[model samples]
Target: MDIFKELQERGLIYQHTNEEALRKRLDSGPMTLYCGFDPTADSLHIGSLLPILVLKRFQLAGHIPIALVGGGTGLIGDPSGKAAERILNPQEVVEQWASKIKDQLGHFLDFETKESPAIIANNYDWLGSLQVIEFLRDIGKNFPLGAMLAKDAVEARMSKGISYTEFSYMILQSYDYLKLNEVYGCEMQVGGSDQWGNITAGIDLIRRTSGDQVKEMYGLTMPLVTKSDGVKFGKTESGTVWLNAEKTSPYKFYQFWMNTDDQDVIRFLKYFTFLSLDEIAVLAEGVEKEPEKRKAQRTLAVEVTKLVHGQEALERAEKISSALFGGGLTNLTSAELEEGFSDVPSATIESPEIGLVDLLIKGEVVTSKRLAREAIENGAIYINDIRYTDVETSVSQLERLDGKYLVIRRGKKNYYLIKFK
Candidate 1:
């Protein structure tokens, strides 16, 4: 398979140093390639998912991939896409975050595969030890002041007064490429479009330093994932959609994709999923014919959620999601209950046994016990989505989900969670 062509067809390739050279190199044989991710956050978001998947695509196509975690540069902070300087974190905190990033990257790439085992390189291993004098004498000398100032990343920040620390980021990233090339024989670097400047800097550094040994080092970048509205992807009203289920529950993760706009879902499938172009073409037809059924959106959600969170978590998410609308809440675990109804109105009680009218009042389902009784008499009150018509009965008579909670549906849409502490 022509991995280069596949990436291009999927619209994953934003820019490349030399398409002809890169394609010819990819066709000749497997070459080592690397992509860097800084430990800017504790968990990787949907934005990082694209390049990580692209790296896996290369690995599946029999190329060596190096997942470079920027423990070194992370401390310095890359200013390529930022509007202002970043507040530096302590060295220990950055190391801890880098360790977490390494774990997340492991889920997608196959390090155990014998043919071309993926390598995880920490720039800290080399960058952490280099003396400032040695860095200036060796790496710094190769980067021309004019060239550094001309990079779009640096140029844009120059008028706003770019700091020396951020201005030096390009050279630091360039040294990473030079080091990886010498150590791993890595010939290519891939990143988001924002890193175009840093990526090219690295390629040039490799050429200048390696001299005759320079064997066609290349750089490629994927488009910065964006919404149809042109806002950046991976954020919601709640915050970043994190890969860690603890940070963003699996149910929420599933919903994030399930909620992809009609205009964005098809393109997202191509960018995020391993589904073949032919299969995606069929989905596109479905989208054109029946946007109401949302088949394409569901497929994209299922494919991506399963890829990231596995079948079991995917099943849990689907179960809770369906139950919320279809009245199957009994099958869910306590943790699932919390995740499913996290945004719903909740009231806590000291005991599970409570008068139905009083419970409804306590749960804030109704303004008063009289209103609660009225709702019950009218058969508008539901316990765990089952209509409860008896105003005299107590909540203890109705089954408590997981022995501790009652899901009260006041009417067709409003839901209130009553928790027994």
Candidate 2:
């Protein structure tokens, strides 16, 4: 598919300057484009994935992408799209987060290649070195205060008030474009729809600050991804679904995608996966025909989970899901069994020795010792997957998996873990 068509198909392009001209330029040769991500958090949420994915798309289509970690701009928070002035984070915190964010992004881009390789840039490199006089005399002159104030982001805050720090956000962002253009001949910037103003500011900066001839620059923004029900995409009641496994576990991440609304599965597949249009069309058709089967949702979940994490994590999550929901647990490794059972309600036995009746009572699996004994007499309990008919049988840590965890199934779907620690 053509560049513009493919991007539009994937719901990537939101706004751009001169699409026809940009398309022509793109066809002629590789062009360098960049998107900046601030280090406001240690892990980038799904909100940030749109731009990162789009950048990867550009690279796959034979272009160089520069991912700018907002180490510098992060210190001076961007006021665009914010309701109120954001709490400024310490410079050291921002720096540390910036490093972490860059490392996460590294997994998605190809940096080892010499041809159209992706580059990581820190705006701090230039922003840190600028003297106040030089910044005011050079970059500050081009950005008129009136124009900056006229922006919606700024005007909306006029009632409350805008800080000098925030008011200068536009200038700083615009200078990023100018810097990219001057240093790397970067001709385009891409970001979410919220960044339109800052992107325009950047284009304006490049045009005014560059050589005698007005240089052409472009901006592209993706639409804000909001669910049909208006729930913010990629967030759960638990919190933001982070790309970092440590922040959001692989099982939780997989579950997030698996639970996507049937209506949103197709859109998410397009937005999140590298699958071709034809392939996604097939999945779309399946989603339409047999949504009850959740064919598309499962594929979307598996592909995205594997992409973000890895194949091994995807397999592990699948295994855990199967063991938890499919009533299948024989194949689970001892370690897998522990990870899967970690969150289940647990009752620990101080001395890993107890009668079946006492074990059931202690585990709260049964209401009382009488009921526990009756359950054992009725062959309702199992130890190590073996049916228990002996009311006097004793349970011990010897039956636990890896000598630590005991998988207890109270009923068909009520599973619990017993720890012997």
Candidate 3:
């Protein structure tokens, strides 16, 4: 099977310009393909994973890839997936976010590959300086009003309201295709399924502007990632699962995949991992026969976490996971402790010599001194997973985890953290 066929089998191709033509084109030689990433946020989330992986897949298949960071269009906002018009970000702020996003895209594609080193292009180079009159004459004239209004992205919001700034997004995105094609010989555009309208708009722009000078260009999108339960993928109770470690720690990132529903694990493996079809088929069988083993989920979590966070981070994440659920935080470093218990409630202690009951009261482990004493005597209070019954025992005597953090367990599952300065 060809590369496009491989994408189809893996369920990555949602829409393509033309299957036979794109396949013949792929088989012909190494062609340049591009995917746009708008820097609406400092870091890309798991929502952007499918297309980034697709770009890597094509690069592995011997095609040149262009990871376009939308420094320009990001300022304008693509109305494709928004329910309402977006608040325009300041230029400097958007530029900062664009640079960060460019760095994040580097984690996926190898820019140093000798065969066809990936290219990172920002649309701002051209869009930022284009005068209004020149833009209207050169780029905006190609887009007919009726066609622009007809797009599902625009039409969906017609009843509620749409802004002129957002309505012109498709044209600006179309110009991105024209600009890339004119400069880098990019023949294909890829994005999410929501971008069908935008991608096709770009394609049409190329067809009109190039006037048979450019060869046939194509567009493809990936399906929107979703869970069987109907909740969106890449989300937890905490918030979005970001690609940045500081935003979403490797431990939480690993846990997100580890908690994948049994029904979704195999599909996610196909979409996210570079594992061979035969290997994935075997894992699928394991999912069928040994649902309780959670073998598939574990593999998915490990593979994805390793891909996104690298080896050392993945190891730390696993160590954190083991320490967390295994009822011990004693072995964790200060950094690991901070990452694992980032969401847990925490209090600070000025001195390490505070009384145990007073520490409990200060940490809010119990409502009051009486409650703290009752819990301590009842053997329900645990300090660093060790039963601490002596209310008079100084906290300084207990060995602190990483010489600073105290793990307080009120009951079996309720956990709190105390930090010594």
Candidate 4:
């Protein structure tokens, strides 16, 4: 299938300008396409996945992918979907964020390919050197004030109020496209639905600047991902799911997808995974025939986790997940325990030997010694997946998995971690 058709099948093509011409251009030969990511945070979140994956798809199809880091634009945040002005980050902070984001983007694209190697560019290199008079005379003159105000980004923020710094973001992004086109011969730009205004503005800038020289420039965007339950996708009660493992652990990231709603699983499979359409069709059937199996959700979780965090991390995450479900914890390593119980109720004790009731009470796993004793007698307390019915039974260092950690279960679901210092 053509690259465009493949993207269409995956439900990735939200909006594009001049589809027929773009298709013809892509069909003719390799075209350089760029997607800009502003470093608003130290790590990119799940919200940024679609654009990154889109760039990957294009690269796999023999097109040059340019991952543009918005070092300059990061200083002046884009107000595309914001209700209020963004707190500007220091120049040093933005540069640091840009460097980290550039490294993360490297994982998604094949930079070492001899043919059509991926390119990483920073807008700060050029934008920083630009003078106010030069910007006004060259780039600013091309964008009409009426059209700028009419854009959804500006219109939405008009009532709430937007600063000149943010309002000028579109022009900066447009200039980025012009610069990329001039330097790399980039013919296309892609982003999420929220960036439709900015993407189109770039296309307009390219046309106006190059006139007859640049006959066709393309813009494409992906849909704003949202859940069937009406909540935003890529978000949990805790916060956004970050690509950085330190920010959001591999286990939690895997669990996020593993818990995908049945209603949204098949769609997410198509959107997120590189699995063939036929393979996804089989999973879709599994979703309808046996929702209890959760095969689709599991596959989605495994594939996405591996893509973001590597194969070893996925294996560890899977093992940790299984261990949490009473699958057994005899083989769990200390590092796995640390990751698995990172967010669970935890306490530290100097000595490894302690009575079950005392440990429970001290760790705040149970409110009182009396309650801990009652829980033990009632067969509701377990130590390392083994039932502990004796309140006076003492946990020893020998019982600790990996000789350092203990996993205590208060009931069927509530678990606590005890660390032996």
Best by TM-score: 4
Best to worst by lDDT, what's the order? 4, 3, 1, 2
Model 3, stretches more than 4 Å misplaced?
212-214, 352-354, 369-379, 388-397
What TM-score against the true fold does each predicted structure earn? 0.92, 0.87, 0.94, 0.96
How far is 277's C-alpha from truth in model 4 (Å)? 0.2
Candidate 3, pairs of clashing residues: none
**Ranking of models by TM-score:** 4, 3, 1, 2
Best by lDDT: 4
lDDT of 1: 0.89
For each candidate in the order shown, give its overall lDDT on alpha carbons. 0.89, 0.85, 0.91, 0.91
Worst 10 residues of 3 by lDDT: 206-215
Give the per-residue lDDT digits (tens) of candidate 3, residues 74-189: 99998887898899999999999999999999999999979988999999999998999988998888998899889999999899898898888899899989899989999999
Q: Write the per-residue lDDT of candidate 2 for residues 128-151, one digit (tens) a residue.
A: 888999899988899887888888
* Candidate 4 global CA lDDT score: 0.91
Q: What value does the lDDT take at residue 48 in candidate 1? A: 90
lDDT of 3: 0.91
Query: What C-alpha lDDT, on a 0 to 100 scale, does residue 400 get in candidate 4?
Result: 81
| Superior by lDDT: candidate 1 or candidate 3 | 3
Candidate with the larger lDDT of 1 and 4? 4
Candidate 1 local lDDT, residue 383: 86
Q: Per-candidate RMSD vs. true structure?
A: 2.5, 3.5, 1.9, 1.6
Candidate 1, TM-score vs. the true structure? Answer: 0.92
Q: For model 3, how big is the CA root-mean-square deviation?
A: 1.9
lDDT-wise, the better of 2 and 3 is 3
